[model samples]
Target: MSKIYVLDTNVLLQDPYSIFSFEDNEVVIPAVVLEEVDSKKRYMDEIGRNARHVSRLIDGLRASGKLHEKIPLDNGGTIRIELNHRSFHELQDIFVEKTNDNRILAVAKNLHLEEETKEKGKRVILVSKDALVRVKADAIGLEAEDFLNDRVVEMDSLYTGFLEVYIPLDMLSRFYEKGELFLSDISKLPFYPNQFLIMKDVMGSSASAIGIVDKTKVKVKKMTFNQEHVWGIHPRNVQQTMAIELLLRKDIPLVTLIGKAGTGKTLLALAAGLMQTEDFHEYKKLLVARPIVPVGKDLGFLPGEKQEKLRPWMQPIFDNLEYLFNTKKPGELDAILAGMGSIEVEALTYIRGRSLPKQFIIIDEAQNLTKHEVKTIITRVGEDSKIVLMGDPEQIDHPYLDAYNNGLTYVVEKFKNEVVSGHVKLMKGERSGLARLAADLL
Candidate 1:
């Protein structure tokens, strides 16, 4: 039986190509959704770009026939714009306001009623990203579901970039003596490239060894720089050690770090970038950036120059830089940045359309970015450049993103098997005990 899917405004804004994801079902677009999308097309952010893209897609669909009538889609599905059923006679008493959500609900409810009378075994479902809208849909006796097309993996089963395997005590000793172990010598479980491994004794002994899968995916090799400190910051745990190994490698150009608050994701990336750019002179410049998503109520706007205006959003980056540089005075850090002429800290908004070569780039708080936005940032990387994306997926600030669908997680899952990309999910919070407690409890 073919079902009817009514898309909400947020679903289209989240992914413009979502109209074609319903397979062979009928896709219904309430007229009010177009109005909502139109209002967002004027902004210069990702939302505006997506809204405009949606408009272009719907406009192009008119070649078949009128959008109000049923238009055949390429995926054996049909799409139509719901013009009538805006009357809130069914929900006026339950929902007094004539808001856009209420109107969308009215259309969905009326469609359900019409389909039920026909007895065609057709189901009418409301698809939305907003939680409250789903709740309201339930109140009005309409089936609702979240848009799950973009989710890379479930939150509980997300890849942690580390694995534990039990081996014989003799094999562990052999790995320690040779400084490497082949995957054929271990269990038959699959291992991704650059994935960290903790080999333990199967007989419950105290001996253990840690190694990383080589690019060939056949051998588990010891970390190259596990003992060395980068920018005066040492790895506090096994996960951090794995992260540093990936960050310091020149062959792996793309690295992703995911963790909770104070897990040293940003700090490790900054340290490795500095070590590679300043200490080794391997890169021409060290560029750090992050998305500008406010946590709580936005502070409206500030009055200042471009850098000064970005101070509030970029302060977290500066804090890590200060600790690495150990600047005691107020203006010392600014003077150091000015004198170096090789370090750059800016917002992610200005990174588009620029070709960056021979540079060490760090994208902090990358979980706030959409998949499209992250792709834009990564595609700008020129030759001989490394880009590190680090963030806490559990603490997303973007209204349209979550732990499973955010860009950080997306990159982690997509690039896990590649030789030039590595990922590590830091498990321990090394900032302080208080911060760790807060991250766990709150």
Candidate 2:
């Protein structure tokens, strides 16, 4: 049955193309949503970008026909702007507020009542990304649902990029002897491109090997770089070892590292960037950037120059760099950073319209970015440049993003089958035993 999906402002802000997602259904945009989108269009962030996109999309649709009336979409669905301008007379007694959210709820309630009077089997559902709004809609006896078109995967089923398989000692020995084994000769388990494997010995000899799954073959891998250490940091666990291999690989240009707090995600990425830029000279420079998302509340404004104001937000990156440089004295790290002409540290705000060629780019706290933001970052990568995105999906500070829908997870899931990308989910925390226990238990 074709149902009416009345979208909230947050839905459109999250995804401008959401109107085309409901196949063969009627998509209704409350007039209030447009007002909210217009208010956000002035900012120069991801939300502002999406708001502008939505306005442009709606304007483009207006050329096809009057938006107040039904407009045919490229998909089988129909989209229309609801200009009912519903008053909160009925909801005023309970909601008791003239806020935009209340106005949106009034629109949904009016549509729900109108649909209930019809004879056809039509349903009116209020779609939003706000939890409180959905709860209020349900309290008012209206059907409410989340806009979940962008969730890449369920949290429990997210790809770990690695698996364990038991191979016989003879097969393992043959793998070691030949340095590679065809996938057809192994068990009938399927593997995505670049999927790591911990091959345990089935003969109970405590012998094990680590290898990456191939489309046609599997090659044994050793932790030579992890053992030797890169920029004074060694892989503390198997996942970290796997991460370094993916990071240092010249062929794989895109790498993603995900884990909880204290998992050494940022530290390892910094170490790899330093090794490739300073030691190996594989890249011309190293660029480290991250989204400047506040944890809870904004600090308003700080009085300083550009670098002074950004120091608080970029301090985490500097901490890792200082550790890598073994700098403890004040201004010592700043001197080293100034002396190193090949290193660049800046906010993601300044990355647009710049071409980064032959650079090792590391984006920390990438989970705070939207999929479109991540796309912009990836599309800016020039030839012969490597980009590493590291973040903990569970620790996202972005209001609209969650573990499944964040940009980091989106890239990890989308690029799992691609040959140029690799991912690793660090399981154990190497920061400290206390920190590891806190991450696991708390």
Q: Among these predicted structures, which one has the highest TM-score?
A: 1
lDDT string for model 2 (1-442, tens) is 8999999999998889888899999999989899999999998888898899999999999888999999998888899999984878779889887899989999989888877788884798999999999999999998999989979997598889898888888888887787677766666776777788888888678988888865443543443343578788887788998999888988889999999989999999999999889999999999999999999999988789988988999999998888889997999999998998888888999898888889999999999999988999999999999999989988988878989899999999999988899889999898889999999888
Measured by lDDT, the strongest candidate is: 1
Local error of candidate 2 at residue 102 (angstroms): 1.2
- Across residues 188-279, which tens digit of lDDT does each residue of candidate 1 receive? 99999989999999999899989999989999988888456888898899898889988999999999998888999888999988888888
Stretches of candidate 1 exceeding 4 Å from the true structure = none
The positional error of residue 427 in candidate 2, measured at the CA in angstroms, is 0.6
> Residue pairs in steric clash, candidate 1?
none
